[model samples]
Target: MSSIPSPTLSAPSPRVNEGMSQGTPACPSSCDHFDLDYTRQEDVRTVVETMMTAHQTYHNRMHAYFKKFPSKEAALLKPHPDTTKEQWKELCDLFTSEAFMKQSEQNKKNRSKLTVNHAAGSRSFQCTRACMKNQESSNINPVELYKKNYTNKDGIWTSEGAREIYRQCDLEGKTYTEIEVYSEILGKKSGYVRGLGRAVKPPPSSTLTTQSSDLQHQLAKARDEIEAMRVAREKDLQEFAKKQAEMEATLRDHREEQWVEQERIRLEQEERMKMEQEHMRVEHDERMQKEQEHMRKEQERLPVEISKKLEKKMSSVMEKKMNDMSKRLFSQFGGSKK
Candidate 1:
């Protein structure tokens, strides 16, 4: 039997001259240089580009092969597209809208941190306003109340649980703003009412009962004192208001008197101005009349002076004409005698 021979591969064409330019000598026919990779590189972009080129070549070849053959069974064997275009578009739109809403809400919350609850764990730890106010009125520190009521086995306080315990407790005197600061400081120092953790055992039931009774008595006493103070404050306010009314009346009367005096002074000033104006007018008229009379006299004197000047001119002209005529007649008689 005859053995089939493998095909021989040719080297790059001499016309290409790429190897010659690089000064690389051509190899012998016996040498197997084809198995070796002479231009391998570790560059990531180069590797990726190589892979993309191979994938594209393979895809084009497969596409052409499939188009030529047109096999229904092979087409069925391939996986279908993950989703339709319309479905994909709808999902992207939904995600965009939801993500935008979430971002907007976060930005809004960041902009307006309205309450103390904006602090971490503060919502579940800080006492309610009403509870704080009540405890503050009773001269009980908020921190102490937090410890007595909310502290669990682990020595942590929860704001939600404190409300029920606060209801059973009694109240007393007026509360001030400073009380809250004091309570917060005490709570911090005690290290009991930490935000968002379990607390240890609270006060015993018997102690709570005793405290409630004492608080009740104190509350009644405080109420009576507050009532008396309110009555006294009301009386003082009424007296002050009455005095203010009287002072306002005096001020109004004083203002009216000032206005009347000002009006009188203004009227006198106008009268003085009017008289001065009238005197000035009379003076001006007299001066104008004198000036007119002087002008009339000057006009009367000017005509006579003008007539005298004209008579002088006429006499000089007549005399010169008579002299000329006499000279002419004498010259004529003399010529005739000669």
Candidate 2:
């Protein structure tokens, strides 16, 4: 099986912290419940983006880990080491379910049809705005912020559509906010805010009625939806925290295992080297003994070889002397007879 590519997860941006500080409910020691002011657009945007990013990050991580196993049944049978059996089973069911698979395939198709993609990565438009304000110490023009987030660093537009939208916004003048420009040019989308990502849902549509009762009913419905979103956001945050802790623990365990494996290899190499050295030493000793034995045999045979040569020389010298003495005696006897 092909290895699963792990998704890169980042810490919550500064905008998330800013949003939490401004809009998150603060519960006292004795109080269990607190209220969120959904009317504030900035706070609402912050919460929405945080929740959406966290949810997407979590879904991607789960899918990446699930891909490690050959099948959903196998994955459920052997849950991730970092997750509980119950959690793993639930994830397996969700990933393998027909409804989810259909949605996932549809999402892929939708992504493939896109002509333009922002270069901002995980940074939301709100975070981009915050950064602009901090760096320039001035309020960023909404159109300029949109351009910055959509275009590349060299100021090239990602797509002709994005560029045309910018041109339209420019011709319309500077009064329009980023969201207003998108809504005006692209037409208002029913479910989500036009410029913001899919996180922030728009207010429900209301009938053009003069009656006070109808207005009250619309307001009540809006409040219900807002409350529901707040509750869902809280739950998402809790799940994200739990998963983050598990990932960290898993990383630590992996590092420890890697270190242990490296140490084992080092020790094995040392043992092999010691054995090689011992073998070389034994060979050296055997070679020295062979040389020494050869020299001792040569030394013992040297005296016998020298004694044989001396005996042969002395016998030849004695025979020559006896021949010379006989010749002299014969010559003298012959002279006396004459």
Candidate 3:
């Protein structure tokens, strides 16, 4: 049986290496190199799982925000307030893609089937292993690491499956390496290492010298990408600041215009009220003058009417007295003649 080749100096220790024949089941290159620490935690599983959770949450939030728009076209036209136009357009395309939708649905189905959840809050397995190595001065066995991550402080297994796997993988005086035991139980997975987080890429299946060269190249590429991203971020921040200032200035100008318009309307209303009051005062004065003129004419007509009535009554009384005096004189003369 052909033995597996030793990894580079940067790779994990030989204890984690799979010593199976070429035909036999073997773990990925990432499983062998436990040296690379992707997270602060020694527990690789917890860190990987936490990262997965955060990635899913970010996508979910983005999808939810995307749904707020009427359509993908509309979303693309109006990018998110926090993100740049290019970033928003890319996200819009991703969210609307059929492949992404299918993957999201499949992920939902897989999540629904899960029965037991890990008790570790945000803590990871890498951190746990680091702590153990610090205390024991030796690399922690894979089985022990699994138990520590799954089980509570009381040493009870988290689930029946976990307990069964632990019992089966327990060396128990047998001659099986911890890596072999884990590979047999967990089975082989493509791409990322089984326990390690996705952030850690699997080493290439090549010579040690070639692997070292490739790693150096990858590191250089990553640095370049990081620098580019930093520059882009700075530019985006400057643009965002400029846009914010412009928006504030526009809003301030709009408010000032509105204030001026309102003041003009208020002044016009005040002037109209004053004009109406003056007109009312003028009309009231004219009415008072007309009333005074009518009262004076009534006074003059009343004296004239009273004087005419008295003269007519006196003339009628004098005529009746003259008739009586004439009749009395005629009667006295007739009696003397007789």
Candidate 4:
């Protein structure tokens, strides 16, 4: 048997990966290269986030906040209590209750009913209008074949024309008895509710009340505002009282600090005085010893008569030292001898 010719390769190497050709097509390798994979992964995460329990983070972190409903039955029928702080992590089953599901279902049902009654009704009406629009001919509706002879002038139909107009669109489909009954029902124009042209009558008090009631309402509103202002002022006064107490406390603290500062200064002055007194006492003892030695030196160097006179002066000097010696020095501190 003749062998079929082998297909020629496009290139020495394959253009596409053999692995890609062998397996099911994956999100492209370029997806990973261009970070599209990570982005798609995040998109998937976002979808999971919406589908999973709201407490997923808390579950993952082991920091769950527990919420409870008034009753299991009530929970099923209504929304659970507002989200709150939970001290401990709990089993996911605790939050999954039949009542919760029932309540969620009930809520969904109520919403569905509202949607059916209002939204669906509106949608149905819209669809019907669309169908009517599509079906409607561009031409104006022609007068009924029997009433073709009737004519309207200045775009206004006369009473005869009006009666004939309703006959074709309204009375045409009804039975004789129904038409006879409906014929008695007169059409009323504007400025009338029951075809009697009687709309509203003001009561004797209504007009009077209307005129004065506005002023009365204004006065009442003003009074209410005044009362509200009074209450607000009272509340402000209470708040101000707290602020005033705080201010007084701060002032008291400041005064205590001032007193402490003054006491510290007074003690410093006392300490300075004590140190000066101690210095003066030491100087006095040294001066007395020097004077006694000087008297002895004078007796050896001078005549006996001069030495005796010096001894009398020495007693006077001793008395002067007692009177003149004091704490502190300098010309500012006046002494009896100086």
Candidate 5:
């Protein structure tokens, strides 16, 4: 017999093979590469870049201030010179402050992005107005931005996010900065341009004075809220304890009432049974006494009846004997006469 030809499996097309080799399908243009609200940790490079920008802006403002007020005896001259140790410490505090940072964010939101070309004559006046506004804005207090931003689970500061990503990717033995660099290389979107550092520059003496007052006010408010919460918590605990005690007392009283009612019913039943038994005993005793009396009367009547029968029999016997004697005497007398 002849065998039929076997069918062969076909290979995949060249385009399919090319896609498989490339490891991933190409993205369509409609698909966005950058996610504005990405959940990943912000990159260190972005933080560094933002810091550099803030520093440059601060430098420019300082140059403009000196140029406008060339004399050393100017009113805007601060107690501590810029970039000094004391000034740097204050700068750090200013940047870390929550209220000031929040105000900066709000200002960013409110301000127009478009740059306007103003005349040279109006530049100095506008600059002065802006400086005064910054001073007024310093009236807002600072929050713990550093603690909030760096300490949480989603934080990348101090290389936490980098370390986590590295662990997930099976990488080991890298410093924090190196891990961040590797994370970027892995095609992860770690880069960000949000408000990374303290957005506001350190203010002069006039602004610092207002900022200090605002800080004190915020601290006081926080303390008051904490105290109020403590008092409310204590009150709630006391109320709970009071309610528990009342419930226990009510239960106890109800149990006692139930026991008392059961005891009363038991006593009543016992007394009723005792009275019935006593009544039955009295009735039985009376019946026995009546029967005994009837028996005694019957015994006395029986003896009297026996004595009467005996006397009648004796009298009959005497009468019959006397009649027989008389008859014999008569017969003898008659024979003598003959």
Candidate 6:
């Protein structure tokens, strides 16, 4: 087999044929010396552009991915384009309502979180009447999806799951008015929003966002100081209560001592009176016996006839003799002879 002939290496003609400048290099031009990072710079620009595009894409759901609805009725009636379009839009709205309702419920749930089981977890949900009305997110049909997935008795949402729900939905770093705070606290079982602020911090296009953030931080610190003061006051109140209890105990002890002293004095007086009464009684008995002896002696000296004549019978006279007995001798001596 014969090898093919090699092509001839011929140089181009050196003569200038065109009307352009003669000194310029043909292939290797002035751009060759310019300091450039062509590939790396292009790669960086491409990466930044791609990230920004992705962020924008996620910002709003794409119409190409999610079909558009001309109107509310159209969204409801013609959700599936395969269906007929002859009927009145409002009346036709009843056709694919289930799909609308399912999507609506799913989107709301996607925005909000819920809990299951007997944990009785708090889920903060749309507590504001205005915000909830603004959302316009509910089932087209009267289907109980929230009730099914989560536990619900009436139309009202439970505080148990509303906490985390409110947390995700709450705006960052903004403080609510007292009324809004009360509604959020009392109405829903507080979850995430409870710990979070009410409104967005550093909102878009704010010129004074930095100042506002500083103010918010300062306000929070002030609130913490006030809370600390309240706690100190509470501690002081507790200490006062302890002191009051101690004082009451001291007063009780003093009162008990007073009662004991009074009782001792009373018992001493009673014993003295009892002794005097007993001595008086003994003296009275002795005096009565002496009188009886005197009477008996007189009767013995008179004789039986005279004694019988004095009071009818001798023994009866002796039995009932003395009258108007002496005064109490107990008072004469305070347990000592007068």
Alpha carbon lDDT of each predicted model: 0.49, 0.67, 0.66, 0.44, 0.47, 0.45
Which regions of candidate 3 are displaced past 4 Å?
Answer: 1-206, 316-338
Candidate 2 Cα misplacement greater than 4 A, ranges: 1-35, 38-57, 67-82, 177-182, 185-338
lDDT of 4 by residue, 119-203 (tens): 1221222122222222343221222211221324243333454555547555545443222222223222222211111111112
* TM-score per candidate: 0.29, 0.40, 0.37, 0.28, 0.27, 0.31
Model 4 clashing-pair count: 6
For residues 39-97, what per-residue lDDT tens digits would candidate 5 score against the true structure? 21232343455467568678456444444544434513443355675664455455446
TM-score winner: 2
Worst 10 residues of 3 by lDDT: 1-10
TM-score of 1: 0.29
Q: For model 2, what is the alpha-carbon lDDT of residue 205?
A: 35
RMSD of each: 36.3, 30.4, 23.9, 31.1, 26.8, 33.9
lDDT per residue for candidate 6 within 67-118, as digits (tens), equals: 4655654455443343334433432343236876587679778757634332
Q: What's the CA error at residue 305 for candidate 6, in Å? A: 9.6
- Arranged by TM-score, best first: 2, 3, 6, 1, 4, 5
* Candidate that beats the other on TM-score, 2 or 6, i.e. the better one: 2
TM-score of 4: 0.28
lDDT of 6 at 106: 93
Clashes of each: 8, 0, 11, 6, 7, 13
Candidate number that wins on lDDT, 2 or 4:
2
Candidate 2 per-residue lDDT, tens place, 1-338, comes to 12222211123345544545575432111011112345545446646765776888887888888989899878878877778988888889999999989999999999889876777775656466555654544445667777887898899988898898778878977555445444454445544554443433443333433454576677778778888998899999999999999999999999999999999999999999999999999999999999899888888888788777777777777777778877788788877899
